[model samples]
Target: MTSAIPNRIRAYLGWCPMTGAAQHPAPDQPAGAKTGDLADSGGSVTGRADRFMHLTIAVVVLSYVVAILILPFLPEVIPVHWNLQGKADGFAASIPGAFGLPVIITLVTLLFILLPKFDSRYAGFALAKDIYAIILFATTGMLLVMEVIFLLIAAGYDLPVITIIPVLIGFLFIILGSLMPYIHRNTTMGIRLPWTMKSDDIWKKTHEHGGPLFMAGGILTVIGSLVSGIWAMALMLVIIIGVTIYISVWSYRYAKTAG
Candidate 1:
């Protein structure tokens, strides 16, 4: 999944995040619906759940309000970056530092908003629309929490960001793992490995295998962060890298053995 296609065409007709620029709708689409919209025939909960997605803008505004409140108290230069040991190393001028997260969050929210429209499996993306909304809102909430904490730090509150961040992230992964099994493969999100690209059965099995592993890793990350903040962050990175490699290999092997 990558920047392999011109975004304009990708948004209109849609293209998988990886593989190639060209794509076509599923051949078996229902007479009056797209491939995944078969569920919409049964009175989908997606519409009710979609309110969470709309709530993201409200969360974004809260971050901006927080930044405005905290700006007057922040020093002329604030620590915008931190080292593994939680030491503030990177610095930025006050105004930019104060509003940093709002700008970043606004851009990220917009990008997420556009990603689904660009997804080649546009219909499949809606298969688990409830999960997607929760995932999106939860992720945005996590970032909002970070923005609040960072602003507090900039306002001279003493906090261990290195430790706090890992715990929060670990929980997020757990939530993702629990919900991941329900998501169908989509080019713009989730696992898009070559083997997963092969078939729906492979994609389904891969996520089923991966869900528990993701939760396990999250548990380890929480434990690691609590026991040793700095080393835990290092271990967290290693776990992420290691898990991705392991999952890719696992999908490949499973794909090979499947009939």
Candidate 2:
């Protein structure tokens, strides 16, 4: 039984037990083609994807470099935290405030890049490579944007944080919503709930519903920001929480009925 487990795992992973070779279609082969008849099928797609990934990494790294360069120019105290009203309420030493946030963002970008390799459900990641790439780019891009905004604020730029932040957030939600439907079931990403993880159909349906909801909420958030920043933040939070709960319950119900 102990030895049987390894074989089972290998089989599940589409690996040859004897040769320890991948049993899946080669990257050069059509999805349903015989493994032996390989061609350079996915090379162009892979190359474009790699270029995008590299571009995202470079942008994130450049953001960090900008932060480091501006560190000396920033005041000893900098606004490190904001209130619901989008007012800078918390202050910290410039060294930590300016440098720490960029460091954390760098670490987060690294984590996002490495997570797929460590995920047991990496096959799902491969299937949803486009979705994964969008997620990576969106998240890293948001961080870079935020870093630049903070740096500008530190440099005495009176940018309208209250309006800009909400607009940025709204755009982010729109991007995420647009891409959410393409994401596949994966343990390391997406709206992972017990039911959604267990049922592919549930995952698909929930994200389908979720995408539109998020888009609507994001639009409302942007409008609210113009009217009332504090209210916009509150409403955005409500929308997110409400959608999450609704999806979780919906997944559960769908799973139960299907079962």
Candidate 3:
């Protein structure tokens, strides 16, 4: 029978054939034998992972601090269009660098770091270590946008140059971050939907498929930058929103039956 083959294989692999249970050490084994036992247990292994998490957060916090310090010495103004048509011009003062925007971001980032220590489920939604680099990239892009806005304003340029590229890069960062959770077993940071949170299988399947779609969508958004028109921007927004909704719905349906 089909079941007999898998049972045999599981036995050969030293795993429980029926429930995928791991073989434990014998009673005769010394107490010290459990040194690496924590690594074997899913719950305990999480502690080791936290070390890396703390280190990453430290670096992120440092970057924000440096930006906050450097911002004040730079420009103090940014240009903006008064109307939707972007025809009327206006200037907005950049207060002490990003006008305390970096402070707000740093606070949010710290909150994200602390959230995982208390709530592992929320940690699942926190940015994963592997994806931390991308999140940082997004942060860097945002800084560029902020700095560029100040510089342009000081120069009296009313263009949306800083806004366009940074926003595009930020979008790519989210798309990239979202993909890692689906591609891997560990889930400590991503766009975790209610469905994905409820059923592991549906979460895995939906992410496995959704990751690539978001990546493609991100690439398209970047390309949208090349074309000079409002319609292109509108199209990009539509794609981003549409793709997000599609993945959310797909994840929900997949979870509904998986249980």
Best by TM-score: 1
1-259 in candidate 2: lDDT tens per residue? 8899976654333222123212222222322332233212233323434555776778777876888899878988999777777789988898788876678767877887788887766555565554565567777787778878888898798877767777778878877776666566777777788887776777778777777777777787777677875566666677667766776787678778977
Q: Higher lDDT: candidate 2 or 3?
A: 2
lDDT of all the models against the reference? 0.72, 0.67, 0.50
Put the candidates in lDDT order, highest first: 1, 2, 3
lDDT of 1 by residue, 159-237 (tens): 8898888888888888777766666777766788877866888888888888778888888888888988577678777
Candidate 3: where are CA atoms >4 Å away?
A: 1-77, 80-91, 96-98, 122-127, 132-137, 157-163, 170-178, 181-188
Better of 1 and 3 by lDDT: 1
Cα TM-score per model: 0.82, 0.77, 0.58
Single out the weakest 10-residue window by summed lDDT for candidate 3: 17-26
lDDT per residue (tens digit) for residues 120-160 in model 3: 44323321332443344445446545544544444565666
What's the distance in Å from true for residue 7, model 3?
Answer: 46
Clash pairs, model 1 backbone? none
Residue 82 in model 2: shift from native, Å? 1.0
